[model samples]
Target: MATCEPLYWRRCRSPIGWFEVGEPALIGPDAILYAMKKVQLIRDKLKTSQSRKKSYADVRRRELDFLVDDWVFLKVSPVKGVMRFGNKGNINPRYLGLYKILKRFGKVAYELELPVELAAVRPVFHISLLKKCVGDPASIVPLESVVVKDSQSYKDVPVEIQLV
Candidate 1:
């Protein structure tokens, strides 16, 4: 008759390391047992925190009401040399238009209709990329103006607006 001893022993490397089997006689089993105990403690702590709960219905919040065909101002950093040059590097002007809101995604994303020229460079923008331009108190135009005409003359207006 032949007797057989265990081929492997349970072992662990560190407090957060995985438990594995190792050569039975090479290392002490105490270190592996200690690591397993620490791992169990961490798991218990995580379970307790997940089970705890509190009511959040009393928290004050504001509801945003945005609809299709509403005018808005988008904050854009102009491309250097392409839009403006030198000394005017820091100017990121707001573009105003009556954007037709197509769809809403979650709380911070929206799909809007933009002009073909602007769409060539930037087709979509996040809500954080836009700011609502109300109006200038001293200006003749109460709201921000958007040029929607298809004539070639409209291209010149952007250059004029940038100068002032």
Candidate 2:
């Protein structure tokens, strides 16, 4: 003998329109519970699939290694006054001479010798803010290739300054 099942309905209203659920409900309470379980199973499967699709091979952490007497390009924020009038600020991406990397503090912070003019301000910077100057390229071909010979020689040379 077949038994009659209780029907369930869900109603939702939004600014744009109204949505109704459980239209033409024909399943028993046990069947409805089973369908809900199936829906949850599908959701869990989708989450696992999406997580598996993520690749971390190309994702790299930024690394900046600065040593004493190494040349580095400092990224300075534009001064307010210079930015206000649309002037290219003084610290605009210029390759300054290799300043001696005085000391390294913590993992990402460092203290360096800055030009006398900039000495009035703080000279410490995070490693992320500094880029090692690998020297200018002599020429450009189909592919961007570094002048290895020049870079190797530059790396070998050390910065020397006499202290008064």
Candidate 3:
């Protein structure tokens, strides 16, 4: 029990400069003033950083929300289902579907009612992946037949072949 209580704290230099820990002088008025200054400096820096981040995010972040039964189009990323989308260079659909929001899972996530054809993909999606669908018949396009081979791969049916 005596060993637990420190008779005298041995002063040691911290790896970081401009500050020292476990020193007897830390209890002095000067040390208190120094610590307060450091805290104020840190608080000011944090405030500036937070404002900068808020401005950066506000520039690009789109605030979208959906109530239950709201129709939304899910974005199709090029990285996902590469075979189904095809390796035919740059032509790839950015968004797919008019899936309905079944339930709101969280603030930024919702459970969608995807068709039976898309059973392989997850039903829950983040708000970023969804776009609030405007009822425009001209905007909707039919997807071509691209047979999925099992759960792992997809085989795109050749629409045409040309050789020069």
What Cα-based lDDT does every candidate model obtain? 0.52, 0.56, 0.70
- Model 1, runs deviating above 4 Å: 1-65, 77-90, 94-98, 133-164
Put down candidate 2 lDDT per residue, 1-164, tens digits, no spaces. 10111111333232122224545545566776776675566567766865666544325555567786666766655555432221355435433334557888988888888877665668888887677867532221322232356446422334454465
User: lDDT for model 2, on a 0 to 1 scale?
Assistant: 0.56
Estimate, for each residue in 54-154, the C-alpha lDDT of model 3 and write its tens digit.
99999999988899988898887777655353335667777776888999987999999988877888899999999998765344546554455678797
Q: Order of candidates by lDDT, top first? A: 3, 2, 1
Candidate 1 overall lDDT versus native: 0.52
User: Which TM-score value belongs to model 3?
Assistant: 0.60
The best-first sequence of candidates by TM-score reads: 3, 1, 2
**Would you list the clashing residue pairs of candidate 3?**
none
Candidates 1 and 2 compared: the better one by lDDT is 2
Candidate number of the best TM-score: 3
Question: How many residue pairs clash in model 3?
Answer: 0
TM-score of 2: 0.38
What residue pairs clash in candidate 2, if any at all?
Answer: none
Over the stretch 65-122, how does candidate 1's per-residue lDDT look in tens digits? 5555555665565665564312345554556544566776777776777767565555
Which candidate should be chosen as best, given lDDT against the real structure?
Answer: 3
**Clash count of each predicted structure:** 0, 0, 0
